[model samples]
Target: MRWILLAISLLPHSLFAEVADVDLNEVSEQQNAMKINKCCEDNELMVDSVCRLVEQYNQSAWIPKFKTEDGKDTKVKHYRFINGIPRCETTQQRPIFDLGKSEDQLNMLSDGRLLHLIHHKHSTEDIKEDLSNNIYSIHENIALPEEREPASYIYEQDKYCMDKILLSNSNITGVYALICVPEVKINWRDTDFILKKILNPLFHAIAMVLFLLEAIIYFVLPTLRDLAGNIITTISVCLIVSQAADLVRIFTEFSNHVSFMITDIILYISLLGAFFWLNSFGFYIWKTFKSRNVFLRVTDVRKYCYYSAVVWSTVIMMAALAICAHFLLDTGTNPNRKMRSHFSSSIIDNDIEQETIGWLGIAIFFTPIAFTIIFNVFFYVTTLKVIKRINIYGRIHYKLKGCFDLFLQLSLIMTIAWLFLLLSWLNFDGLIYAHIVVNLLQAILVFYVCVVRQSHVTFLLRKSCCYAEPVPTGEWGDEMTHMNGGNY
Candidate 1:
């Protein structure tokens, strides 16, 4: 209730420091004549006029020219102008707003340089485009200041061109003007926020809770802690930590200044965890089928710990290098001009060296990832072929069941999510939606396959629900085949 009240209290107040709610009598507010610096090619005369008619304007919109989509019009909510002229390049003329303003003469030379502030929301590589060429099609030449703070603002310095401008003010949503700086606002009531933060986190939380429940179950049955289970549990732990950090990041507005670094570190940890464990899972599946036994000799804790230390060390070193890239290359006044965490992905779009410090991080993080994917694919296919080969000596029914069990293992390890990610990398339009859904639900799907559906867990659940006494471990069915090897 207190959090709800606090959020409500914050809603009515636009968190913008001084621009939006500045006192009308203050210095910047008093100079209502919209101020902008404009320059052009050689022999360009001094621009001495201010558009006065803009003061009485009621409402407006900033239309943008999207270079990524040919002949299509796009809209931008805001723009930031560091120091640039809003001009029409094709006509070789300075932009003249239809609104009223005065032109005053001043001595100045034409300098063909301009700076443009862009969207507070960064665009994904597939959909992002430069719109400078289309700036002349719009009447307004100022960036619109945000009306309300948006939730989950992501502005990466992947490159921003001042050529495209979208301007807005306190009341009107300006068509195209560059703003100086903007703030992202997230509202509890916003539907988009509900979907991305509130509801999405619920899915992740459910997955985490289910993983914990399964961990508790596995703890009581000490024999269940085989290499496969160990890998599954570790992957669960990684997902839990990753999701928890994402929850913190999306919900807390101020966390980016402090807790965000931890989030960045954990992201890599989760990625590595998934890679190593998924490969191990494929191996466990293949080994079980070849040996025709559910139980494999477990490695000693010392060896397991040593292996973990090596993997964690590798992850930490790479993450630290990305951290160095973040600080070393991020040299600019623009807040967006910095390294971003999303660049940790293997996708080439994120390796925007010109706009972000992704070159170092991409090389270090994605190399092993590419190999992991290739090996996992190899293992998965080989496992299926081996299963089919083994089926040659088994009954028809048993052969079918074996193939089905392998299919379940594929689902548990999130084959679909990787497929979607690959599709997204290929730039298949409209697949990002599927990619997000499959990725977010991975933990839940894993829990369902690896735990809830397990014969022991189901038996235990039935006994508990029926108010029956607990069964002895000796009576547990086919203990050797916990999941992938369960049928044995």
Candidate 2:
């Protein structure tokens, strides 16, 4: 009897265990159902058991549709999409009884109502009480004409009219007419003008003046006619051309398309030339520093010719590639094209074509510049390592050290300016301002480094001014003697 009781207790334990497992499974299923339902919000719907946004939910559709009291179909003048939601405004049409009358009038009343009048044996008048607030609200404060002239009459007669209102006959019937009122103000201040017009052009002008002065000094002074000086002069000339073109593009309005294109090409070529010359400067410094013979002349006519050929050829080729890409490529749009078109008087009729060209132009222009800067950085690092070794051993002369230091400073300034320019294209906030400031200061920095602090330049200036006697066998003398020998 006791064994039977033990078996019965064991059976109850097994049954209770089975019941608990079923209860837990039921609880889990209920929890999963709750989670699935909770995953989607009110604005979302379930598709394939996954939550997704309702792409076409427009809250404006709930509002009552706009209609004219005359029951005529409203004509949609323009429509645009904002965040995937469609927004459009319609123009109301008023009919005239006679087609030959020159005095049929449409007027904007003091309270923003449009008054339409027909002249005949008995005059008929219709006043449109409700106007599109988005359109007519801009002229609410300004006093518009009591009689709105037809667009054709305004064009033929050249009469002064309100800025934004244009009246034209409807396509369906010559007697019926529609009035155009833009949804936005045309004369509002654009914030971008502050950068493009005021800041960039001013800095570019200042840089251009400094570059011009530097170029003049390099060319006129017989003391500065070495290979290094020639290279610096070329760089200055290129920058001058670029800055002049840029200033012209900003200040002058281009009425001719071909002229504008030519100016643009010239600007790109000159810009590329400036950067390529800078790279040439780095290459020359590297070659000079890496040479084993310390007595070897730094100036070589054949080598300068070679560098000039290479830099000019590369710049022209890159500019040609940019032109070809602008004509050929049909990829994604450029975001800044609209801004350019708005600021400049050049009207871009084809959006896709202009966008492709703009983007391609940017790519072609910046790719080579970026590579040039990178190569310059590599050359600078290698040369700095050599200079560091020489400094440790105390074998390098002070004049040679000063020359190298000048090259280093110029390279660093150019590299940093170009890097900031490249970063500005990423469209980060305030980076453009930083780029402008750095580039604006670049000309002054270059002048200070290459002219003011340069031992050779100061030595020549002092000798010319009778302020000090010329040193016979020093660093500047050695460089000048070698340079003159190579030139002759």
Highest TM-score scorer = 2
What's each prediction's TM-score? 0.49, 0.53
Off by over 4 Å in 1: 1-190, 255-257, 287-310, 317-359, 391-415, 418-436, 460-488
Please give, for residues 190-244, the per-residue lDDT of candidate 1 as tens digits.
6544555566567667767876776666555444454445655676676667667
Global lDDT of model 1: 0.44
The weakest ten consecutive residues by lDDT in model 1 span 100-109
Top of the candidates by lDDT: 2
- Each prediction's Cα RMSD? 18.8, 25.0
User: What are the per-model numbers of colliding residue pairs?
Assistant: 43, 0
Q: Tens digits of per-residue lDDT for model 2 on 308-380?
A: 9999888888888888877667333322122132232111110111121366686898788889878888987
